[model samples]
Target: MIQNSKLFIAAAATLVAAVVLNPTPEQHRARIKEAIAERSPLAGFLGVGALTAFASTYHPLGLASYTTVNDHTVSIGVLGMVFVLQPSKDT
Candidate 1:
């Protein structure tokens, strides 16, 4: 039981670190591509099949945020606190 708790803690910590890193848009795109190439479930978890110019809103209690906009935009909610990935100016 103690070992299991330790393993769970380690997994949670790793996830928190990954989320906090907040991959760049390019990196996010690459991640999606790689996931697809490897046929990983993470592909769908990343987001839409492909990212294109689009508008999205993040509700106060939203779990995740995603958008492809021209100007820089940012939104954070309750669970969003876990994964804070703000949209930057699309170049």
Candidate 2:
């Protein structure tokens, strides 16, 4: 558990550093997509699908909060999955 926590912290720090370096929009998108792809494609798909489903369930007024929360969850899942899967450089 301690090792896992340290690993998570390290990964989060690396991601933060990468973003702070102000990568181009395309680079950001590609990095994020690559991370997501590193995880099981199905997992990434499901994460986004779940967020969309949640957003769809709510009315417009209620949707903002739902979308915000769901988006954060999905993003974290994608990032974590990417870190865990550790895709190859070519990927």
Candidate 3:
């Protein structure tokens, strides 16, 4: 329960920060393109497929806060693993 609360808080903070920063549309598109461009062809295909499957799971929940919190944890876990595996550019 505590961990889930922490994840929710962190996500809230991130959303607040984004709103405060108000990134330009071009900046947002550039960032999105950079992210998509980094993925291999096979990985990108599977990622889109998996995301579609995940979206299909949302019908029952219908945009509940708890469901969002659960999804955030999955994203946080994936990002945690990626950060752990990747070395810092300054190294």
Query: Worst 10-residue stretch by lDDT in candidate 1?
Result: 52-61
Ranking the candidates on TM-score from highest down gives 1, 2, 3
TM-score of each: 0.29, 0.27, 0.26
Higher-TM-score candidate of 1 and 3 = 1
For residues 1-91, what per-residue lDDT tens digits would candidate 1 score against the true structure?
9999999999987767655554444443444334443554564456543442123332221223333334443322222232234334554
Clashing pairs in 3: none
Over 30-89, each residue of candidate 2 has an lDDT whose tens digit, in order, gives 444455545558856667533333343211221121112332322222221211123246
- Which pairs clash (backbone N, Cα, C closer than 3 Å) in model 2? none
Q: Report the Cα lDDT for residue 88, model 1.
A: 40
Candidate 2, residue 48: the lDDT equals 52
lDDT score, candidate 2: 0.39
How many collisions per candidate? 0, 0, 0
Error of 2 at 11 (Å): 26
